[model samples]
Every structure is written in C-alpha cells, then in structure tokens.
Target: MNHFKQTVALKDVKCFALHGYYPEEQLTGNHFIVDLETEFSPIGFDDELGQTVNYEDLNSIILEEMKITQKLLETVLKNIISKVIRLYPFVEKIDVSIKKLNPPMPGQIGHSFVKLTYTPTN
Candidate 1:
C-alpha cells in the first residue's frame, strides 16, 4: 500500500526549561526553542479535519514533554518523539529539534541543542 505523507513544521516554539547538566541550570529555567516535523497519512482525506491529526493536541503534547525535567536535550527529544508516536498511531515518522537560546558557555551567545528523528514500526 502506498502511504501519503504530510509534513508539519512547528518552528521556534518558545518555552521555559530546566534542561541542563548543571545544578544551577536546572534551578533557574531558561528559554528554549522546539521544532517539530510530524509525518502522517490521514485515513480519509476528504478535507475533513477529524480524519487527520489535530495540531492543537500535538502542540499540547510538545509542551507537556517540555515540562518534564531532563538533563540532556537528546533525552527530551526522544521523550517527545515517543509520546507523539504513542498518542498518534498514524504518525509514521517524526523529527524533533531542541535549542537553548542562551547557554552557560563562555564567550558564547547561546547553548547547544540536539535533533533526533523517530520512525514507528509496524
């Protein structure tokens, strides 16, 4: 069967996070940017919203994942991907990118981030 893929890109989703290895970083939350690309095929594409993924719900899922405290961005990304896949069975693949606006690195304007891709298996 041929599958139809729909790509959704949510860019620069601002949030406050305590995602870092240092104790101070976790104690004091900082700004974060999350980008998501969710790929899924709607069961019935008759221009009906119900037949496809609800973007509002998806945004909530991302926010919920961001609420959970984690040291590594990779872990957070993986968690988001896993939750998204679990919540939406039609989501065959997802790409997540997380960025810290201002990191604690010396002479650097911002911190590092991570990006990960997830694909569900039948």
Candidate 2:
C-alpha cells in the first residue's frame, strides 16, 4: 500500500539570531534565513486545522528556538528539528535549513548554511 504524499512548507523566514563561533557574533548577532518542509499524516479531505499541520505552530517553534544563544548553526538546526518532531507526531518527514547571511569571514561569501532532514521510524 502506498500513502498519499502531502507537504506543508514555510519558506524564507528571516530572523535575527546570536549564534556563531566568535564572540562578536554572539554579541551583535546576525540575520538568518529559515525554511521548513514537512510531510504530514493525512486524514482524508477534511478541512480541519487539527487534522493537518499548523503553520503558526511551526513558525512559533522556530522563532522561540532562534532566540537562544548557540555556537553553531548546526546545533540550532538540530534543536529545531528535534523540537518539531517531538511536538508534532503527525510529522513523518521534515527538512529544515538555516542560512547565516553576511557571515563575518575572510574573502567574499554570500552566506553559510546548515540543513537537516528527519524521518520518523514506525
């Protein structure tokens, strides 16, 4: 049997976070781009908020987690993914990506990013 695939996405969620390997980053902070895509359980064609993914909840989770101080984008990404999976069991698969804009580094660079994908085991 094959299950129907449905996706819910939150894209280009820009936020400011104090996460970096340097002291200046922790002090001044930087802009980050966040994107979330999740594969959720389907319950027919009902138009119920409870039966599907709530994007508000997803946004809140990312916003809340981004405030905490972290040394690495990977850690931040991991934490967000873990929290989302734990909070919403209906989420079967998820991909989260974080990009640090204008990273303070040598040479010219656009941004640094970290992405992680999670799939539940049943």
Candidate 3:
C-alpha cells in the first residue's frame, strides 16, 4: 500500500568503476551513473539532515556498490537495495538506477542500464 508522499532524490551521479562481463571492460572501467529516488517519513519541525536521508551518503553507497565486478547489472542493483534498506529503514520506497555510459557493445549504442524500484514493508 501507500505510506509517504514526499521524496528525496539524487540524479546523474557519475563515477568510473570496474563492472562488466568481460575482463577488458572491467579493467578499463567506464563512466557509470546511479540515480536514486527515496520516500521516507515526513519531516516535522526538526529540519535536520538526519531527519531525512543524505544524498552524498547515498551516492557513496551507489559508487561503492558499482566498484564490484558483476556480469549482470541486477547483481549490482541488488547490493544497493540491501544496503539502502539497512541504512534508511524509515524509507518506504526507493528507486535505484544504474547506467553504463559507454557500453562495450557494437557501435552507436550509447549506454546500457538497469533500474530497480523498491518498497519496504512497515
């Protein structure tokens, strides 16, 4: 069901990391981006950073997860989901998107990506 209405998001978080199916692609890494959307408990009068999730911390988690080599993008995304859940339990829903800017595919293929949306149970 539904819970929260407000959202905290981070978009176009770019980084270079080792994640690919082939050894060459993994070794020479490529530009990668991770976008996030999270819905947490509504903030009251506290107005403190801790009251809501931190964008930088989320980026760091995404970057750290991307560094691990994986043959499939889903694996990377799964890692992020688990980490985020552990970090921010109040978050009711989350959307994490991972994009490989320069995929090693054929010519003209701009990028490849996997985006996952999650809604935790209360």
Find the candidate with the highest TM-score and give its number. 2
- Residue 79 local lDDT, model 3: 89
Candidate 1: Cα lDDT at 66: 88
Candidate 2 has an lDDT of: 0.88
**lDDT per model, in order?**
0.83, 0.88, 0.83
lDDT of 2 at 24: 90
Q: lDDT per residue, candidate 2, 31-103, as tens digits?
A: 9999988897586677888777788988998998899999988888888888888777778899999999989
What does candidate 1's lDDT look like per residue over 19-102, in tens digits?
A: 888899899988899988888776786888777777777688779988988988899898888777777777878898988987
TM-score of decoy 2 = 0.92
Best by lDDT, which number? 2
Model 1 steric clash pairs: 103-111
Q: Candidate 1 vs candidate 3: which has greater TM-score?
A: 1
TM-score, model 1 to reference: 0.87
CA deviation > 4 Å runs, candidate 3 = 1-4
State the lDDT of candidate 3 residue by residue for 1-122, as single tens digits.
65556788889988888788888987888888888889877765377887788888888888788778887788888888889889988788889888898698779877888999898655
TM-scores for the candidates: 0.87, 0.92, 0.87
